[model samples]
Target: MPYQQHTAKKMARPTGNVRWMVVGLCFLGMVINYIDRANLGVALPGMAHDLSLTPFEQGLALSAFFYAYAAFQFFGGGLADKFGPRAMYTFSSLWWGALTAATAFASSMLSLFGVRFLLGAGEAGAYPSCATAVGRWFPKHERALATAIYDNGSRVGGALSLPLVILIVETMGWRESFIITGILGLLFAVLWIKFYRDPRLHPTLNAEELTYIEQGGARPIDPATEEKISWLSLFKFRAVWGLMLGSFSLNFIAYFFITWMPSYLINELHFSLVKVGFVGMLPPLTAVFGGLFGGWLGDHLVRRGVSLSVARKIVICIGMLAGSSIALAVFVPSGAWAMALLCLSYSGIAFCASNSGSLCLDIAPTGRHVAAIMGIQNGSANLAGIIMPVVVGLLVGNENNFSHALMLIGVFGFIGAFSFIVIVGKIAPLTRAKRVKVADAGANNEITH
Candidate 1:
């Protein structure tokens, strides 16, 4: 069926308590998800020193989570579709938390790798489920902003992880730091189970509000319909492949900085731990503002009559180009200038991620089927997490340096930018043929239009 035209009636936005309630919960979930992951990188220097790990071995450990995470993306989405976001969210949160705490018990590389891998498997559902919730709860115009608001968790997690990890590692031990971070996740899991309700199932949701969300293009698909959409069928489409490759390329750049920046500051630039902890937050701090700004700009462009395709692709391309180019600053003589460039580069990706993920929803044939699509995209992207750490390990091993690693990432960024422009094509629903053969039950009959 064709989309019904909106008759010039603009619905009023939800006022007061309800709006705040939803945003607050989502924001907390985002924070919990990122903070747990960020702690590992922050604590890595100490963990490495204590364990006597080589750069190659350290990279292997860092990439361990992604090994399982990338594999579980599809499974996570299936679980979300089968059990609903509430159950998936609650279970994943608790499961990852438990795995994170288990890291404290590790005395060897194998133990740490095992725990991290489990953590990844448990947390695989995080972003896709969050995207599903946004699809269920927000209007189309508001999703970018809502996504940006929640995505600040990455910044917050990265920012907070530095100081918190430093403090905990200093006061207690690196092991305690892992345990503390893990326990925080457990608390969030309990809260999620208690608070989240599917919008249709919530008696408090008003008709006017439902109509507003629905009119703005939110599709309240039956929970059952989520399962009816086959994950393998979604994978067969060219667009799905585009999202997968694009997301993986983007993560190749992103996870590098996320997983390695603090160590880079210490080893390459000769920064003190105190300085690393304090100054490291500046990039993510800038990223928070960049994401918010990018979200607002992308949505504004759409409202001004630009197609969603053009708006998303332009923002993402500009951000990737800027990010990749700024990486060249590593060659400059001044360390301060290099750090500033690094900051600007990640800020660009921050902006891009804020808007780009929402494109999955915009182009998904039905909002109901978005989880599986997002799952594949996320899974493919996370494969980069596995590949990046291992590659960085190879490039920056004991005798080698970062020059080749930096160049490789720059090339990837360039390729990723081209992909959005050339390969992504228009942001519209995919067409499938409507024609089907008509058969007579008893005898052969001519079909007429």
Candidate 2:
């Protein structure tokens, strides 16, 4: 069957309630992704104690995942662009799931580090694939909403992890906790493979929905299409550098929260392990709302005739300005109030973050090359994921005060805001070779509508 005809037929009669199912399933994938991410953190104390690891050694082990994860984001993005997200996501889930499960068996630091590094490599494709899926399955207006929906998984997963990990670690040990979470991810992978398809590829989607998506500027990419933008050539474009530097700075803040926040809560805030789990989960919980709130606001602004550039910038600017304030909360006299302020800060960060992937697409503006741009941006951003852990380890390993670390995060947060606000301009594409598809015929339609 011709591709259009196949989609047309499916559009005439989509499968039974698949749209909602697709959303639910993708949500699960994200949930599993985060559970896998946070599991190590939950198990960190046990792992450190069991292996007799020094703080530096533990930091190295913890950072092994980011080193490989960051490096492979480019490869993952390229592969996703080449093969489509369905297969890429499915394979990533399975590979990373198995690796995570295998982490339970590590008797030595070397083995633990090896598994974490491999886990990072395996999971590298997750976000690029999510972006690819959003590009394929959603309309332009709904793009941020869809991103918010999946992005919220990080928070939900983290939230769920605290209780789940505490229970499992208390009863069965950290190994069993890893094994159980790994199995859940594996199960979700099987379900995803069975259920998901591109909108044009799905049997359940109707023509109305497909048309609506196309009307909102979804374009299909031919998987067989092959192209590459060299690092040198990509660097020549100022927009690429802007995104790269912006992502890097944002991630500096992010990695501090992700890798060190729990330690801060336990060591500085004097929270017990179980309490630390719950408290550590708070920022992420607020982040879930922040992502949704930001996405909704950004879309609403777009609907109200604000340009995508302006809308994105406004959301990011507010988020950075407000979110960075949490860093200074470390100095607050009251701990409870301090946590509340930090929560507010992370909410802004989450809201600001929901725009980065979408902004990449805006800059690309034509071809379905988001995964490629994301690869470059994420690769640079993830360097923070790797380096921040090591730096935090050095700063807090000897010094009792983590205030310096918090100060650093605040500085980077402010810097991240500045990059997005100042360096990135007008949401314009860098490549003249890539024509703006929707803009040519109806350049101001969105603005005027």
Candidate 3:
């Protein structure tokens, strides 16, 4: 592809820092997206008390969102691929915002479950769209940083919710917190639809910036994927499955912190709601640093002449080793000391996670497929999300010992490390097949057409 020549030839372009502006917008969207989702965990504890639910039932409520969330991952990606990032993002944000508000109106366990399921389904498209958008707007070199900047929202939102949602629950009540957060998402959705577009189509994007992006390896939109690859062909590559497996390990650990950690502190450790909320802020705070450091380090390694494949894997493995701290932290008795260890554990998790989105873009065959690939990975990971909460709930079932669940989480981190090192051979785009066969329908379409 004459990427440089084509991009350089464009006359009208958007002005300075608009690419970074796009990254900034996505970052705020991520923060808002997470705060809406993460608040449910904080709210669940209170909702359980009022509803007179068992731990098992509350676990069901916790897991319900993931059911829809996991199921929609592939669908969301397809939507992003077909519709473009702007429209899909706008729709998802608006839909989830509406569902978040609907959550406040639930009167029974079934109602809450339905609302959560809908909410998860609504939000499932968000990250995949973000992944697709990043692939479009930024070059390959800056993807990790852009991903970290936005992905940091998972931690920032979680960290912010620690104080924000819990204090709202402590004061005005849990229902109102949903109403407030939902409104924020609605507002962001409007802003996003108004400002965002594919870089090739972006009216404000300048020629110099566009050329710079393409020169740095930004992928142009591809219509070729429509003929080049089939849904089954995606499975022909091992990278996709490795990503799916690794994401499962990561999400299993993440949901533990996001959905259950607050309950763990309150129920087992006997901490006050306010106290737990404040301390809960710690892990996400440290995770912010992890996201930043991981992005910069990964990018730095690539710039220093290291292979992108090796750099991503090395970064991922080191992060998992650090993340394995969860197993040891389970044994610590002191609340403050345990908080310290949890912080380290989450930082490592974020550090490793900072690369996951980049990996999705790295392997995407074209700009259009970025979200779809991400969705496959996300959906697979969230499949575990659907299972782990219930698994942990069953494991804890009226017991104070979280050691078993905690160890399971730590073990998953190691599994993820192994998958990246051994299973996912190289971080590169999926190349279309060259051999022409009667059965090679995908290639045959390209050849015959």
Candidate 4:
């Protein structure tokens, strides 16, 4: 189906903001997704004592989730692309939710690891589905902000988990915490199934808004005519590698916050459980605004006629550089000073994350492959999730000093900055013509400009 064109004057009339509602759902899904995943980190202290786990064992259990999560990302993306976001989201949410509830039954290290791994597999479909949905619903100029809105859920959920999970763990026990979050996910799946539809099929979306979306570059869902790109073939593109490497580096540092921040507060800084619940929330909470600002700034730049490539790169580089402040925390003497630096570091990570997600949509071969590409990058990035916890666990060691770990995360921030600034080239869709050229030339050669 062809897009309906409308003049600027006609477009000025009320077109409705149904697209915002779609993004709102994406946001809620992400919030639940993070809450389920991050709950373990907060509950780990009590859980470790209850199960008689070593620090290494705790790290192993934490890393276990990423093993399946990273492995399934590509597969999940393909499923999202093939089945549509609505089905993928509903299926993934239900699967993860059930697994989260099942975590309550884990009585041993092996069982906990097994449950967390399955939960990872179920949660892997989330962001890819969100990326696919955003590509189909929002125009280019608005994509970054849309990405930010949903991605902010990670920060929100992470922040909320500190206090919420702590309260649940204190009141009802850690097992009950998992059950409550699990039920929340199950409920969201029902809402998603009932309300989410493609722009073309949405009963409430006005024609004017649809036309505005299409004209501004929102992809209209039409699978019959969509081009199918080979999944393996994506590796031939230099930009794809750049995205993978860049994302991997970013996640290397970011995962430290997800898996170890609470531990760092409790063990290294010697904070009480009550203080951990309140103070631990600061960095991620600050990150929430950083992500929103980054998203808004990127979109604002595009609307002011900045090239997409330049606009995105500038934000990404700045964010990564800012995130390098994590290292500075190690040199600080006071806990307040250390928290300030950590907060800055997390804010910078969130700032870059919004645009990093947008890049998947920006460089996809077509709307059909957005989720697949997202899966590829996210799959690679999540390897950090598997590595960071174990690495931090070892570095913290018997003495429980986190200085080495902080320095390592800070260095990776610089590496991530370099990857985005130097490795990633111009931002544009990789068309079929380019794909065919790479195929003809052999995957050994980089994609032609």
Count clashing residue pairs per candidate: 0, 3, 5, 0
Candidate 1 lDDT tens digits, 322-391: 6685458658797788788877887887788777777667656665566767787789889999999989
Which structure is stronger by TM-score: 2 or 3? 3
Score each candidate by Cα lDDT.
Answer: 0.75, 0.75, 0.82, 0.88
lDDT for each residue of candidate 4 in 1-449, tens digit (9 for 90 to 100): 42222223333533599899999999999999999999999899999999998999999999999999999997999999889999999999999899999998899999999999999999999999999999998888888999999999998899899999999999999999999999989999999999999998999999888877887766555567666568887877878888888999889878887789999998888889999999999998999999999999988888777888899998999999889899998899888999999899999988998898899888877777889999999999999999999999999887889999999889988888888777767787776776677568654224554
Q: What shift in Å separates residue 24 of candidate 4 from its native position after superposition?
A: 0.8
Ten contiguous residues with the weakest lDDT in model 3: 2-11
- Cα RMSD, each candidate: 5.6, 5.8, 4.6, 2.6
Give residue 327's lDDT in candidate 3 (0 to 100): 79
Model 2 Cα lDDT, one tens digit per residue, 1-449: 10121111123322434444566567678888888887887788787889887777877887899899899997787788788888988999998899989999999989998999999998888888877777666555556667777777777887777778877998999899999999987897888788788888888778767665655555467535424444345544556667777888877876666667777777788889888767777888988899889988877787667777888899888887777776777689876877887788778877987776577656653345677777778888888888888887887775546877777777877788777877765675445343233335443211112
Superposed model 2: Cα runs more than 4 Å off: 1-21, 222-232, 433-449
Model 1 residue 241 CA deviation in Å: 1.1
**Total backbone clashes of candidate 1, pairs 3 or more residues apart or in separate chains:** 0
Leading candidate by TM-score: 4
For model 3, state the Cα shift of residue 143 in Å.
Answer: 0.7
Candidate 1 runs further than 4 Å off:
1-9, 16-20, 223-229, 434-449
Q: Give the lDDT of residue 117 in candidate 3.
A: 97
Top candidate (lDDT): 4
